[model samples]
Target: MLLTDTHTHLYYETDDVKRAELVQRCKYNNIGRLFLPNVDAASVAMVYSLESSFPDLCYPMLGLHPCSVKENWEAELAAIKQAIHQHEIFAIGEIGIDLYWDKTFLAEQLQAFKQQIAWAKSLKLPIVIHCRDAFDEVYDVLLQEKGDDLRGIFHCFSGTVEQANKITDLGFYLGIGGVVTYKNAGLDKVVAQVSLNHLVLETDSPYLAPAPYRGKPNESSYLIYIAQKVAELHQTDLETVANITTENSKRIFGV
Candidate 1:
């Protein structure tokens, strides 16, 4: 079965020479699809250019990442809107509130996030949430703004079964990543309790690679590592994990 990496940032700060080799390794590892999320206006061109060059392999999503919320966030939001109007992006994402690193612009981040969620609904696209140490704060915004139209995956989900149930009840998929394979990630309980339909596989690559590759630059090929761990936890085979996650991703991104 073909595996799909539902979340990856292959072009982020990547060297051209290594990019060539990295993609070859992905092919060898059975990864056929890679979803690239836009981080900011600065990275949008690169993300789309990568998608254009590898249309058969890379798919692009356009949205300002949560970490990118800053003083010029309004202008950045306008740029994101213009890009949405101009091109055919899969979804609005890598978007959400992040309170862990800094809370200086938490308010602005929420505003940008909800505004983008509304935009995603207007565009008839899903969202890709990037919650970190702020699930409660993020969920507050979601509870207010989310509706049948505002649906997508909670990328890099690491939460309680209750939280997982809450997200899944909203018809959003949980993005399981390298954290699942860690010895003490705490994702094991959530993965075991959540059904396959509410789950999607990802690496958030060039970032959180699974065990053995932990503490190193992640790649799409490492998606299989996370998928394999999910399979083992769910007491199924690797292909089963790949198949269900592929279907779940298609449902969310409409790819």
Candidate 2:
């Protein structure tokens, strides 16, 4: 079965030993494609280098993460614009409102999110959003900027059925990750409610590892566990889950 880890931070590991092990395991599990997202200007080199090292196996997206928004957000966005022109970014992503950790930069986060959304539409590239405890705020911007050309994945979705429907209505895909495996996550019910056609699989590795490894660091190879959970939730086989989500990944990333 073919699998696509649409969101992973393979570059987060600077240790060669761990990196090599993770890469090998992903290969063994048939995770053919991995998408790396840029966090900020500081992460640009690492993300690009990872994709450069594994051009065939990995893809990269350029954007300022909501959590990374700070005082000098304009400078960061400027750097992103320059990089977008210089690099072959698969998407403009890992961008959205993240009000969970710090609310001090709420204004900056909102501005950055809207600016990045404009960039995605201007570049005609898909976006990967990172919404956390700010679905309504994110939806407000998406609504204000709504257009036929705007599209992307709602990375690490943890919303209700109504929110899921609103997302699909905007031509966005729900990025289902390890959260669905949690007994009380209720993400399984969300998954069961949404069709496979609108779902995509992700690991968000080095974080949010599925059950059996819930509290531990996540890795791309562990995507198999998330896939198995999705299969069970959909009342289907693993290969079916793999095939459908793989196609959804390809459809969005065009990779």
**Winning candidate number (TM-score):** 2
Residue 136, candidate 1: C-alpha displacement in angstroms = 1.3
- State the weakest 10-residue window (summed lDDT) of model 1: 11-20
Q: Give per-residue CA lDDT, model 1, range 1-255, as digits (tens).
A: 888888898987457777878888889989998998989988888888787777899888989888999999999989878887787888898899998899999999999998999889898999999999999998988889867888998999999999999888888899999999888888887799889889988888888889989999888888878888888888999989888889888888888
lDDT score, candidate 2, position 194: 95
**In order, what lDDT does every prediction score?**
0.88, 0.92
- TM-scores for the candidates: 0.97, 0.98
Model 2 per-residue lDDT tens digits across residues 1-255: 899999999899988787878999999998989999989988988988888777888899989999989999999999888888998988998999998999999999999998898888888889999999999999999899888879999999989999999999999999999999999889999899899999999999989999899999999999999999989888999999999999998889887
Off by over 4 Å in 2: none
TM-score of predicted structure 1: 0.97
